[model samples]
Target: MPGETVEASAGSVATRDARTGGGTAWLLGSELLTLFRRRRTWAMLGALALIPILIAVAIIIAGPAPTGRGPAFLSEITNNGLFVGVTAILVAIPLFLPLTIGVVAGDTIAGEASHGTLRYLLIAPAGRIRLLLVKYAGAAAFCVAGTLTVVVVGTLVGWLLFPIGPVTLLSGATVSVGDALVRLLAIAAFVTVSLLGMSAIGLFLSTLTTVPVGAMAATAILAVVSQILDALPQLEWLHPWLFTHYWLGFADLLREPMVWDNFIDNAVLQAGYLVVFGALAIGRFLTKDVLS
Candidate 1:
């Protein structure tokens, strides 16, 4: 009788484990689809696309840059329109770009909680960690999508409006049109990687509040504060630690002899931010009360 009771209890525990332990991939897929379907996602992408178009048109109408005022890329846009696209991305990455990521990432958890869907999601067998991963994946998808919008639109608009061909590197070496395009792709990837830190920070903030607006505004404000601190001469000691300090380092990618030092630092720094904040979000979410 004792042996039979122990066996029966073990079997019930096994059954419960089986029900909750699998299907992680399916849950991730469903969350990705839901993120992609949101109207706000599409609208944010559309707005981002307009930046490159406006840059190309303005450069075309204004004639060649005087070479003394605007960015080095702008000065060369009249020579090869490719510069227009790259230039647009450079402009966006510092502020407008991260703001978009903040909007999406900040809303990841808080939005659902605000609308009372988070409790229902937690009621499933997917558990807290799995749900958080799905949320992070959705935010990461938005980062890639937002960067690609600028890249694709910038390239096409530049091609249609100006000469498209071989490009002269910042180091004075010439690269084939094909090579230049590849470099542009690398630049876009770099920009996307740079935002992962912001995404992580935003998601962490989202876990702190049920109000999506508060999360979104707080995330953007933190980014702004970091940038401002990075600018202060007195805070030079803290530059290396600031998330935005190396954001513009993608410029090194365009050099004839591609420099990897700053680029690598940027990636490593972002990865660090992601790990720290992602852990914080998970730890807090695990203990957080979810009555909504």
Candidate 2:
């Protein structure tokens, strides 16, 4: 019996085949696990969490800000803690959010190649398209995570440091705490979606080279430049097409009737960028040689 080794069972091989054929979910989970496990990811999240804490602390120390003196909804934080999350989002949307998204998305493929693991990943039986989708999904997951970090942390920090009550909308309507919480979550979702275009751009750039830092910088710079262009009066004609144009449109969700025009416009703009850059990344990656 010791000399005659038993052969592998047919069921085992069939099970392995099935797993290999339907492993996209497994791969995505592994990708997200790997992403969140990195210290850099946590560090970025911690930095984001500080935004609200610092805002709340400063407001507490400096006394209530006069209306129209600071960030929108900042003065309101003295009355309702919920505004803290919204105000933090307004502060972060300009640069912090995009900076973090750039790092994650830019590192997607390039990080694997930089670590000399790209070849192994491809040989893991992951099709290029599948792998690319998983990478984007991972980046997208980080977007959600990062945005929620600010919102939830901001809310908690605000609650501990400020009063909680009904929030007044810009349109002269007040809403209950429960309704305001829903709007805060909606704002977070809008902020997350706002970063997708940058994510796609970063992913495409990541495929261009093995230098993750370069891709990250380019992605961040593009975000800054887009905003600058959006701010230029002479370039007003191009504002509608710019990805950053509708970023702050999350304010629409806070309105009494809740305007949907900006939300719809931003979603359409982001989707267009996703399609164009996603296709480009796919084309470049599928044909490129994976030397690493």
Candidate 3:
């Protein structure tokens, strides 16, 4: 018995399965807990919440009446989940949300590497791919939370300070406050998916570098470049292919009858990015030697 390798009994195997499942659950829960416990996370959420409030106050002080022309100042600021909860999804998608997600995700793997913990993680029975997936899931969860925080806080602040009636969209269509709220939620969901692709890209980049700062900076630069490329008029043919291009597809949700063609296209494109980047991250994480 001392020299023999004993196979696990059926009861032991069942217990092991239970433990593995519990470990995964704990990993996810602990990651969320750790993220929220950080002072930076609270500070970031507070700052985002203040953006819409500050903008609403600025509009009120300026004394501009709501108009049917473009989005009313209040509506623009409270766009919530629609874009940055700002006027247009196009502007907010590139302007703020991606940067926020990038910073958090970009730091994911690299932060562990920088601290010399990645090697230990890789050595664990959970394996490198599973570890990477856990980190990705954690980062994506944070992105969703951050985006929702901005939308919910901004909307409440905007509604309290400004008018609470129908909103006029850029397309010159009118929608009731309730309808606008629904649209805003849909936009938020879309924006969350869009940012998930960015999160995956950031996570992938994070795996390629040990310096967390470098990963963060590279992700931001990539996002900025992608946004610029998305804006080019000459690249009309390539616009649909750019991840940043469809970020504003949420605008379609605001239009009467709701344009599914472009919205669905954007969703599909973003999904593609998510899949590709996630696979790349897992592949590199599994194969790369973490000598550090």
What are the Cα lDDT values of the candidates?
Answer: 0.82, 0.86, 0.68
- The candidate scoring highest on TM-score is 2
Could you tell me how far off, in angstroms, the CA of residue 106 lies in candidate 1 after the best superposition? 0.3
Please tell me which model should have the higher TM-score, number 2 or number 3: 2
Superposed model 3: Cα runs more than 4 Å off: 1-21, 65-91, 168-175
- Where model 2 places Cα greater than 4 Å from the true spot, the runs are 1-22
For 1-292, candidate 1 gives per-residue lDDT tens digits of 5533443343333234335654766666666656666666788899899988988888878787788776558888878988877988987877788888889899888977876667766776768887778788889989899998998899999999999889999888999989999888988888888888999999999999999899999888888899999999999999999998887888788997888888789999999999999999999999999986
Query: Which residue pairs come into collision in candidate 2?
Result: none
Collision count of model 2? 0
**What lDDT would candidate 1 get against the real structure?**
0.82
In candidate 1, the residue pairs with backbone N, CA or C atoms under 3 Å apart (3 or more residues apart, or in different chains) clash, namely none
Worst 10 residues of 3 by lDDT: 2-11
Query: Where's the lowest-lDDT run of ten residues in candidate 1?
Result: 6-15
TM-scores vs. true structure, each candidate: 0.90, 0.92, 0.82
- 214-269: candidate 3 lDDT, tens digit per residue: 88888878888887987889888887777777676666777786666766777788
Task: Identify the runs in model 1 with alpha carbons over 4 angstroms from their true place.
Answer: 1-22
User: How far in Å is the alpha carbon of 168 misplaced in model 2?
Assistant: 0.9
Total clashes for model 3: 1
Which of 1 and 2 is ahead in lDDT?
2
